[model samples]
Target: MELKPYRDNVGALLFNGAGLVLVARRADMPDAEGAAGGWQLPQGGVDPGEDLRAAVLRELAEEIGTDRAEIIAEHPEWLTYDFPPELAGRGFRIAQRYRGQRQRWFALRFTGRDADIRLDADSHPEFDAWRWAGIEELPALAVSFKRPIYEVLAQAFGPLARALASAAKSR
Candidate 1:
């Protein structure tokens, strides 16, 4: 079989002041295959010719509600993941043309209050629910294919996550 290219995408790990990362429940989870109704960080495709940083911010606003987050750090390397065989060619708009995603991940500090989030901000919402979760909790909450990425993120951002959590507790 011919090898297919991966989709260029951007992912955000939005952390509150307390260090909990933001996760959203996919509103359009595939009904028959793939992980069923699990939480995931905000991510979307990078538009052709779009700058990576700009794409990250745009994806945050598009997937969540507000772009009230500041970049803390970025993963040093681009991360790629493939969809489960069962999910390949499922016609999902984001994955329809590719084997999976090649993502540039960002670590962002959310500057907005919880009230600032609006699942309905877009005409078609991607998430039905949102919550803040501890860094270690990410891997477990994520779908299987995404777990490895989350694990790497948890490690890559561990220091910042701990500091934020400590600061929040001190307040």
Candidate 2:
């Protein structure tokens, strides 16, 4: 067996004032899959010549309808995951050509109200529904292949989320 190439992708861990992070259900995911928790953070391919930070914000706005955010931190390194073989040929943009994603993750603090989120903002929307979920719940909510990434993020961003939530409470 040979290793396949990965797509260069940017992912967001957008945190609200309440400390919960944003996660969205894929528009293409089946109802049963959605019910089984087919949710993930806002992410997308990095457009050629786009900066990593710019890509993250663009994905947030394109996927969730708002880019009102400030970058707090970035994951120290790129993380990679494999696409499950069973998911091949299903028409997922990321799965079509790439083995999976070589992801650069960022932590962003959402600066806008919940009403700012419009799932239909993009003519080709990536997600259908979204919600603010506790950071600890991320791993459980992620697809099996992406669970480890979510686990890492939960540990990596947990402190910042708490701090932000606390700060918001005091405001």
TM-score per candidate, chains pooled = 0.91, 0.92
How far off is residue 60 in model 2, in Å? 1.0
Local lDDT at 10 for model 2 = 96
Q: Write the per-residue lDDT of candidate 1 for residues 81-154, one digit (tens) a residue.
A: 98776654455655555778899999999999999888899999988899999988988988898999989988
lDDT of each: 0.87, 0.88
> What is the Cα-based lDDT of residue 97 in candidate 1?
59
Residue 23 displacement in candidate 1 (angstroms)? 0.4
The true-versus-predicted C-alpha distance at residue 114 of model 1, in Å, is: 0.7
Which pairs clash in the backbone of model 1? Answer: none
